[model samples]
Target chain A: MTPKVSRFLRDAAPATPCLVVDVDRVAENYGRLKAAMPLARIYYAVKANPAAPILGRLVDMQSCFDAASLEEVRLCLDAGARPEDISFGNTVKKESAIQAAYAAGVRMFAFDSEPELRKLARSAPGAKVYCRILVGNVGAEWPLSKKFGCEVEMARDLMVMARDLGLDPYGISFHVGSQQTRTAAYEAAIARVAMLFTDLKDAGINLRMANLGGGYPVRYRAEVPEIDAFGAAIMGAMVEHFGNALPEILIEPGRFIVGDAGVLSAEVVLVSRKEQDDPVRWVYLDIGRFGGLAETEGEAIKYAFRTPHDGGAEGPVTIAGPTCDSTDTLYEKSNYRLPLALDCGDRVELLSTGAYVTTYASQGFNGFAPLAEHYI
Target chain B: MTPKVSRFLRDAAPATPCLVVDVDRVAENYGRLKAAMPLARIYYAVKANPAAPILGRLVDMQSCFDAASLEEVRLCLDAGARPEDISFGNTVKKESAIQAAYAAGVRMFAFDSEPELRKLARSAPGAKVYCRILVGNVGAEWPLSKKFGCEVEMARDLMVMARDLGLDPYGISFHVGSQQTRTAAYEAAIARVAMLFTDLKDAGINLRMANLGGGYPVRYRAEVPEIDAFGAAIMGAMVEHFGNALPEILIEPGRFIVGDAGVLSAEVVLVSRKEQDDPVRWVYLDIGRFGGLAETEGEAIKYAFRTPHDGGAEGPVTIAGPTCDSTDTLYEKSNYRLPLALDCGDRVELLSTGAYVTTYASQGFNGFAPLAEHYI
Candidate 1:
């Protein structure tokens, strides 16, 4: 078990099936990111956790925010973040939300399509808008498909359209993808952004800022390169591509800033064998896929489990959530193993579960309340 | 478009991404079930959709409730359902929840394992308990896998254990699976239950009730047999297996009771082609996996979509939720087609969505509100 989790388990004594976020660890993760990319301004992605305390901590640290909606902008503002420090990162947005965010003083927004640009033009005139260009999301654990960004030609046209619509064609942005691990992915995306910047300039729209959208990875079950390594690769690519004309760099990181700082302490609800001779023990917990662990999408993201009896004999186990729903099974095909001695009422701490949990929780599915969150 | 959806769209100009439930249709579906299965007591599965209005309507129809948690028990009770009329159907439950349900005057419960039996014995002594036996879930649209039910041998032992622990082993139950279309699956499950009933009787335990757990299929993309067809099959099997000594029959139907009674009216947020040569138009809706409609798991359950321009030229399209997450894509691989003329702000109503859409909603992922439900 990591010392962070051990300390949390010892000190917090949190209710079962609750998330315990360590604000100290969050500060440390922030420090690490700042040290890695000193020149780049950090915009904390609010979608990852959106817990009030986490947002408050980030605001206290003077961190800018990447707000996806008007509600998110309100959350950051409530947490003491200035509207000028918030960027509406979602390219596809409701016109009402655009007007609301603009009314609340948010000036930076992202758009990838002409319709979205038109909505922005009507709702928030003269706002600093960025065009997201599509790039390969190779080697990312959660590779974002073609959902947000547009092609380079379309992005160039969109930038010109933004200028024509009386909006600030302020920047170019591209997401390598969420939980991205490869340094080359950054190099390729930065190169694409450089190409887009030159093309937009040729179209008489000189962008002033480049938003390197969030994709920075966090260490889960697998080993990820150090934060410094990602910084070095990004800095090297920016210098190689843009030389003296590098736009002001900005990063919107979600997981890397908060993934490691949180730990989930869920209780073992039941440990039984469906068949008497079955080798794998089914370990059911109070929390499941709907209870904030949706990131276990297809069991692709394996969370490290720690039990009180960690030193005991280990045996193969299929972990499941407590819901009656069949899809709530956490890890069955992954050959997950746990201490043989684990039983009902025993606590199992899932590590690195800080990000993408709370916000994904269902509203009392099967009569069970949403996962409780606690910050220490 | 279905007449129900058209009427709803015409009368209720509800906000985008809202669920419109037809209570009259709910009454009709309930009446159909009653006419089909006259002998079986209807225990409305509250997990399908725990909306207050639906529960109140069910309560007025004199429907028994299959509550999965204490909160559900409370919901049913609040909706005017007698505590005696509610069954705690979820086998895996927290001891505190069991205690709360018992204290709330619930005497009927279900158990599958020894640990659970012990918990029930302590929290709900003398309660009417049913042992769920594992059965094949073939030909089920939503096969439950092994998340619920125990093998026959283990269930037999657990029943005897329940008797020893001062809990009443009052019945045997088995779910063929949710959305079960095959009549043979019910026959096979009933035969196994009959054998268990005889075995328990010989062991000096007279099981007085039999629960044919919820698995009734709903018509979505394909046609389903009428409620009478399922009732006839179940009645024929019960009479064939148990002869004249039939126990009190109980059923917990969730989707079948409410599935067809509701329509989801989601607005088109965006309709764009991701790539230049891509023929598939990506249609984004305000509601996605997080905003309910999680039943689209693995793209297994295909929901029928209807637009205002249903008679217009149809084109291949991929449906997606409005969340920033890539996994929120709903129907990329499902060969979904929509009206080619559909654009942003146009409404597309998802049929047969009343049962599983509302309660399964995530709590505002990506800063989007949960899907609103309006009863008409």
Candidate 2:
């Protein structure tokens, strides 16, 4: 099915199989996040595709980083982020990784247990420790609550221990889960985590800020809860819990700020037929499971496949990536309307793949290069 | 759940996250396949994983290759395979890729469309064509018959055209599907495609083989069909259909021959306490999404987490890969009976990942190194 008309076609557009980022939209997203939580310091989660140019733009927007690894910390630093602006969000602290972060001048760190605290104390003794408490329950849909973060009682113990050991327990943190759709889940977690601050205060440990660990759902597909609503709910919950006594809020939003602004565009080099009830069209494109994992992690990102000109006709096609594996499929059911019949050497754009589009999934299969990023 | 007392003490071994292929077993598998298919030529699907060593081993075993791309053709050549031994199995051909394959002297090609036939006619006019037909109604669970082949009616037309144009339509091919569990599907498809050979001979365009394409299931988990039974059923069906007049038989056995023979091995770098669940041992191993996509596809590859030495008590734990994405999981519900308590810097091994294990779904996220492949 073709689009009624094509308004986006340009003769000079580079070939497909490239990652395109809407610079204006990403910057606007950054500004929106800042405006929503004006008092909160934002850390761009580099764990989502940490493309240098994208990180550079985030740096330009005055965003800090929530880095999960030493390499992520280095990536932000390479993109001109100050080491002091990055928080090592990964709670599992290996001595070398912590040492690398410390060497990179990263001041803030997250600790989920006494063992991690001991590692930090032994290695980067002066690093600012943020007690990562296991905050909310993300039910069976995604049970990320099972990963890292200390329980409330254990968090209180660690906070008390940190204060007693003359270590800086500057903040408290909680990551609800990634790709979170429910704003209520976030609000409840915020209210629950805020209580930990009051408990620590009762124990005479004054915390500086509450790191509401990221999971601001990006508009991957469907009506993603508005970032403003999430920010307001968390901010409202913080005010209701502690009023003026609340610490400065710090939020880490990775996917929300970047996910929808990116598009992976590739050309169909060959269209093969498969045996089915109908002759299924196998549109062979450059991007596959490795390049666009968001597609495989269904519901994480919504995939809309379009040819360069929407003015083409539509069909039911199974988009196969270039990888030879039969499982390497981008979309099982793609219903699209384009300007003309798409044949070999036609480009298709996969929308809303910005945040986690690139950085990690570069498999050099077929000697096909990784998508060279282009900022529009 | 620790495996019962065995020499492979969950930890006191090479490491966890290591792909340890029992070379002897893989060799036995090769021997078994050769024994089972006395008349059929085994075309090892190199697209499963183009590891040079693995290719070399197959070459040593006199296995022909089902090359999907120019690079795979080159890999096979580099592994010491002769040019004539490789079949360019991909039906959708790019001009450059076609030129490369021709230059590399790939003689057997699978053709699906008239346009593809024209390309072959112009580029490599003398090459033998395999009239690729879709296994329509072949009740294989994955029925690839939907994507890469032509309708029987269209295949008949192509065969007539090829003969008229002096092209050698030497055989008919139909891939039931990859990891196919049903033997009846292969039998039915064989019966159908074999009729095409007879039809061609009746028309005086005699062809030699009817390829029952690769769909032989590989053991990912314990629930897969018995290979011996499957091979026997396929042989039985071939005899039942084309018996005395049966030309040559060709089967592309990619996963079955190599899948269980390989294991993706890596080591645990960090272990963290998850919020609500058990300790999520963040085994930051060297392997990633690229090594093999079986884990993501929900294929039944058994994962066994082990270490170098008996360190502590044995228990089941969740294994997370080094990739930053929340979906980067190896075994979702595997019970690794660690002989000792596994901590940071411990190793874990994923068992039976030989086929499509290396570079098939690699995402070099966070700069995690590729799974280092080793041979026994």
On lDDT, the leading prediction is 1
Model 1, residue B194: displacement in angstroms? Answer: 2.3
Tell me the whole-model lDDT of each prediction, alpha carbons only. 0.87, 0.69
DockQ of 2: 0.33
lDDT of 1 by residue, B1-376 (tens): 3476567778867787888888777777888998999999999999998988889998999999998778899999999999999999988888888988999999999878778889999989999999888899998998887888889988888888899999889999999888999889999999999999888888889999999998898999999888899999999999999889989999999999889888888888888775566778888888888899898878878999888788988889888888888788888888888888898878788889988888789988988888888887
Q: Can you write out model 1's per-residue Cα lDDT over A192-308, one digit (the tens) per residue?
A: 888888887788888888788888888777898888988998999999999988789999999988898888999998888876687888889999998889988788678998888
Instruction: Name the 10 consecutive residues with the lowest summed lDDT in model 1 chain B.
Output: B1-10
Model 2 chain B is weakest, by summed lDDT over 10 consecutive residues, at B1-10
Docking quality class, candidate 2: acceptable
Cα deviation of A87 in candidate 1 (Å)?
1.3
Query: In candidate 1, what fraction of native interface contacts survive?
Result: 0.61
A1-376 per-residue lDDT for model 2 (tens digits): 1121112224346655677777667778889989888989999888676777778998998899998778788889999999989988877645788888897788888887776787788777767888877656462133363456667877888888876666798988887777777666667777767778788889988888888877777654356667778778878888888788878788888777787777776777776553324544667676776555544544334466666556546656666676655555666653523343677777777767776667545455544556667766
Error of 2 at B140 (Å): 8.9
Fnat, 2 decimals, each candidate: 0.61, 0.34
Q: Give the TM-score of candidate 2.
A: 0.84
